[model samples]
Target: MHVLPERIKSLRNVKGQSQKELGQALGKSREAISKYELGEREPDPDALVLFSKHFNVSSDYMLGITDHIENKAFGKRKPYSPELYAFEKYLKNQDFIPYLQLAVSMKDSHLDINSFKNPINKLIKQGKKQKHPK
Candidate 1:
């Protein structure tokens, strides 16, 4: 069986949400949700993102690309750490060539990747301060 249909149905059932309710939450029609669960249709990318956000599971989990439901780094929770989420989103949307080049340059310069952590952490702290100013 295809994992998408099974996972969607299972997650809906586990959440005690009827197809109508799930559809309402996802801005999809109940019939559409049923079709998805029956494997008669596959969700588009937008719907897939909605499903992932609604269920708090990774897209990989929904597609069965990975068995792990929650990202170990984030755990199963809402309001994921903004800094981490932003970084993750950035990485997902970016081309890897620049990153690869940077890595090679860093190696040539004898720079440790770990050295960036402190500066990144400082920026995160600065962002928090700005967001929640005293």
Candidate 2:
């Protein structure tokens, strides 16, 4: 669906920016910005990265994966760097079990959208009080 333009405009309004001002931050001409906001043309991946960081939104949010920005996924994660390419190649060569294991390990290292145990959703340490005064 063509949800990006609408959401982008909404985000711009939230930031109190004019199209030209937003374009400057995003390193685009005002006309290009207008076209993107009008849904005349979609932003390319590079521009999408810039938009995500500039707007403090996620690529998923911009792409309309979920309506709530809180559900957004972050990370530029460009798979073009030598390290990234190597990892990508390694992933392509991996068996499913290894991949699953690596993902589980990653959960210990970084929080993710589908990770139920992400600390953001965790209960902090506070003594539980008895409901009926046991």
Candidate 3:
């Protein structure tokens, strides 16, 4: 399946948009849109992000990882959640990418909560030690 091309075309059709119209909306060229739908080129990250946002679809769906258009697994995310808000602030304070990688790795690992406790506590201790060494 030519996922990107097909998906782009399908989404454009659903939105009742011509390639030229989509290009105008996205500040791109009609030729660019044609190339994307023809699978002659792939969209850059920014363009992909734009498309996902504009269509209210997941990047996974746009990339063909999932058939579902909306990410139902995320359960209709609100604009804000207390825990996520706090976590985002925490990430902003810390080295975001490394912590993001760690979080993703842990989530992907599916370890038991008990199993995670020791590693998490060790990281906390390390942060404290770095903050103030005796």
Best by lDDT: 1
Q: Tell me each candidate's TM-score.
A: 0.54, 0.51, 0.53
Backbone clashes for every candidate come to 0, 0, 0
- Candidate 2 segments exceeding 4 Å error: 71-134
Which scores higher on lDDT, 2 or 3?
3
Alpha-carbon deviation at 17 in model 3, angstroms? 0.5
CA lDDT of 92 in candidate 1?
76
- Of the candidates numbered 1 and 3, which has the greater lDDT value? 1
Worst 10 residues of 1 by lDDT: 77-86
Q: By the TM-score metric, which is better: model 1 or model 3?
A: 1
Ranking by lDDT: 1, 3, 2
Q: Candidate 2 at 90: error in angstroms?
A: 47
Please rank every candidate by TM-score, starting with the best.
1, 3, 2
Best prediction by TM-score: 1
Ten residues in a row with the worst lDDT in model 2? Answer: 123-132
